[model samples]
Target: MERQLIAALAALALVAGCASPQPAPVQLVDQQQYTKAMRDNSSTFTWPESRKPDLAVLAEKSGPGRDRAPSGSERIVLEITNSCACYLGWEDARKRGDQAAASQALKVMDEVLPKFSPEDPDGQRYARETAAKAKAGDGSQAADYVANNCDSVLWK
Candidate 1:
């Protein structure tokens, strides 16, 4: 009876160990890795060399400045791009009729949209328009606008 009890405990311990949850896999992709992957993947966007300088400038100007935060237009452009990406992914999922994936993507966009500057008029306007459209179930149109106009609005 003693030996049987020990074996049962050992088996229970093994089962518990096997049932332990594991940490999620980490995804580490640096800029170089992203650039290389984008270059190799024809479907992915490869940012132009000419726009690198502008991107660098924007990166530099993004954080808090001496007087105030970056301009509303700048913040709007950034938020739009971010939301647009989410919407685009959602659009793809919607195209496949994957309601769960689409809903998840929209949830992500909803979380991000409110981060835009409410004080900035242009930013507020952009946010309102986007939110209205999203609420009206025009996510695909918003995604298309973002994918098509990112260069004009963002890079310029």
Candidate 2:
């Protein structure tokens, strides 16, 4: 009986150890209430209600020399990440040769490239050349193109 009891306790210990832990409870706050709280607080800056999502509020708050030209670096980074994801997906679409998937990825890159800023002459030229190369089936040129020109023109 003692042995059976010991075995049962051991089994209970094992079962307890195997159980998954519970997640913490999340607290949800409404936007207006949060905004009101922020406004009421002396430490925080109160934002106007008319401020939209796309407004450069953070940049504005950064003060002088913050309102520079809109560079496409962020867009370029997003595009490059998307392109890499598409390329990996395309690779899995066929056994030996998936020309269709490759073509689809190329089309996506082409569509996204034109949306980049042409304000920076060097970046613009590099972007155009890279897009042309990509269209011509030399997609590998993109990494080199980005590395050479993206930091100089896209980023601040």
Candidate 3:
């Protein structure tokens, strides 16, 4: 009877282990939500007194900064390019006739693009594609592309 009881407990433990809960499903970024988040955090934007961009924080908030950042070339490509969706701000500013704001935002993107490197051909190609869109100040399209292709880290 004791042996049978031990066997039953072992089987129960195995069943319980297998029944562990799964992680939550990823909630992808939505443009309207991203827009609201950006606007809400606008006043808190600390772009630095020296006008230098916080590449690390940008990676964390917008791209793959820490654990998500893998060594493969494709990793940084997705990260910086994904953050390039910031170009959307520039696009919106231009539409409102705010040339000064647009110029500054564009300049910031320009400075950041060269910093995104990919050793592989595929990564390089992707980088170039992102760079072209950023140069054109296509923020809306960029955000859409990031949502579809990259990890869901945009508005987190």
Clashing residue pairs in candidate 1 (N, C-alpha, C atoms within 3 angstroms): none
Candidate 3: misplaced stretches above 4 Å? 1-78, 81-85, 133-144, 149-151, 154-156
Question: Which wins on TM-score, candidate 1 or candidate 2?
Answer: 1
Better of 1 and 3 by TM-score: 1
| lDDT tens digits by residue: candidate 2, 1-156 | 112322343344445545638533222223333233322331222111221112132222211221221122223223333333433333333334767765665554556444544434665565566567766756566756444433322111
* Candidate 2 lDDT trough over 10 residues, lowest sum: 46-55
> How close is every model to the real structure, measured as TM-score?
0.40, 0.34, 0.36
Which portions of model 2 show Cα errors greater than 4 Å? 1-76, 83-96, 145-156
Sorted on TM-score, best first, the list reads 1, 3, 2
Clashes of each: 0, 0, 0
Best by lDDT: 1
**Could you list the CA RMSD of all candidates, in the order they appear?**
20.1, 22.8, 16.6
Error of 2 at 90 (Å): 6.8
Cα lDDT tens digits, model 1, 1-156, are 122322343344455556768633323333344333323432232222222223333333332222222122233334544555565666667788988876776666565555555545775566557656776778655665666645432342
What global local distance difference test value does model 1 have? 0.46
